[model samples]
Target: MKFATTVLLTSAIWTTSALAAPRAGFGVPPKAPGDKNGALAAEQSTSADIEYGYNWAGVIHTTPPATGTYTAASATFTVPEPTATDDSSGGKQGASAWVGIDGGTYRNAILQAGVDFYVEGGTKNYDAWYEWYPAYSNDFNLSISAGDIVIVKVVSSSPSQGVAILENESSGQSATQTLSADPSTATLGGQNVEWMVEDYQSGSSDVALVNFNKVKFTGVQAETSDGQKIGTDGATIYDIQQNGDVLTNVTIISDTEFDVSYEAAQ
Candidate 1:
């Protein structure tokens, strides 16, 4: 029951569309990032290759329990006001903070919902979105400002059916979307659950990641089909490593809380 001051909200009707070309989306790891010459690329496949990503950071539940499939995951985070940095993507830098089931070891489709932030020409902007991986993300017309508390959740009714929810605690408004894993041939494996900070794709290239000082995901949790709730107790941590540079740091403060800090992009 805690919040920052000066919270604000804007609203628009929720809409959905299927996009195939030149769309923006959170993608599977293209490869582990390394320096300008692909140093990490030529190195042996260490744990970093499994834990590091060119576009993702945060923690993932790599080892699930032996008995049941995971059904849901959620996280609470404060909206970050991204600032334009020197190595900017031509005023087109941003990041996505999301929670989802699969797409970690599942490697096919991700069921997720959360927020996208961008700093263009010194202006900060945000949008709430939900997606079933390989399909482009559609936006929620929820106007949000820096420091607002947002809670996002993804639930799977079955391997192929699910729902995503995005709630703005400060505004008392929310968006919910029931989803299906149809466009994507991959269904949820229910093996990996994760919370991520991602640098997404725009067309064939990545948008430069701006400096999002610190984004902490609290109330971090997941649940099993048998009704058991889980936390970050046994999770494998991941950070963004691009071209021989580590771009972010993830600190697990507790089972229910963690923080990701931005490092400069080259």
Candidate 2:
């Protein structure tokens, strides 16, 4: 990743949409609406529960330690869909969510419990793998050793003490991050979740957000960059290919809270 000598802890505990972060959709595929509460939704729930059971981790030193000089590059984000998400939601509907990952080799990744809340119904899932391109070129340097993962959470920002952690395999280095807002009681489709990228090595990071307004599955209008009206199907998802296609473990913490973990194959 590129070094931004100055690093700020962009830990703004505010609830907004998914697209709220920067460069969240540089060259990735645009996500259209998917099924309201279809099979994909069930898969998300099942996947999230399984993925949260155990922490995803790996070690990089085993592959090959930096020999001559230590160099790093920011992984390219080039998938058709957004890296993290607050899926199709609207003025009156439940919550939807998704997660995708790029390439990387790690020792351990864990989903720590945070604040708790209650919700009627919603779905969430995660995907991990390598991509041909990174999210932003100028933001970080690209290298074979570096990689990125995607995490998506859909829920009301009910005040809870929940956070997730990603640990470096070789160095045992790790970073603790908050997933959503800290509110007491929140209604489904009423709040937004912001996806973030933090550099554990230097503590610098960039943020992207998708607000509640951006999430709409059916009977609503969506605006593209060209200003064309589009109907959201709320079902389409990106695919994972080759040596990296895998689903993380998940565990349900409560009706509204849960844990998810996944690893990007090296």
Candidate 3:
């Protein structure tokens, strides 16, 4: 979740990919091709009806009181299978859908987990993973596919420690792992939880964006440090933007549900 601090200020928008360096940790997975030091591109999207960004085409929680300390966050989403696009840059386009805590106003770190839906070489790939910011995400051994119901949760046992769990409800398989917060980095504030789908980026180059028709998140909830459960009703909608355009519109369906409609901005 670490990127250049300039992104936090909407006025100082920059077009280059905002990828951060990977921090050292256990279970560090190998980098994927085009992945720069474990840094994923900032999400960007486009559409006249929605807002935009570099590769992210989803909603974020950005309104006031939306930022607060939290202990845990969870959500269930249907994995999307986006059609691959032939990028003029000689790469395939794709997106990753995930729910996580932090990375909004509290930008220091993020504790999150979710699934990646991508198309490469005309083939679609779906995989589940969990991440503690500044470190490369670790992939789960469980199998995943488009349309599968997946549940992901990240819970903080303490400010610097937590656990991430991912389950494929349809297949009855799951993965759980312990996550230690980086002491050298900012402590996760547990504020600003989010559910989003982002276009994968490699360094400063934009990866092709996959057409993941539509994706929805249900049972979206979080627990505060004081143990109160917060739902989508308590959150403010944030549209992912690139330059000055809106790419997606986030609709609050209910206190526990929300939907992100892709505007398919090129």
Q: What is the C-alpha lDDT of each candidate?
A: 0.69, 0.20, 0.62
lDDT of 2: 0.20
Best by TM-score: 1
Clash count for each candidate, listed in order shown: 4, 61, 18
Which parts of model 3 have CA positions greater than 4 angstroms off?
Answer: 1-68, 86-90, 243-245
For model 2, what is the alpha-carbon lDDT of residue 178?
43
Output the worst ten-in-a-row residue range by lDDT, candidate 1.
1-10
lDDT of 2 by residue, 97-129 (tens): 222111111101111111101121332211221
lDDT of 1 by residue, 108-143 (tens): 666877787887677787878887765655666676
Q: How does candidate 1 score on lDDT?
A: 0.69
TM-score of each: 0.81, 0.21, 0.76
TM-score of 3: 0.76
Which whole-number lDDT from 0 to 100 does residue 41 have in model 2?
A: 19
What's the distance in Å from true for residue 125, model 3? Answer: 0.8
Provide the lDDT at 127 for model 3.
68
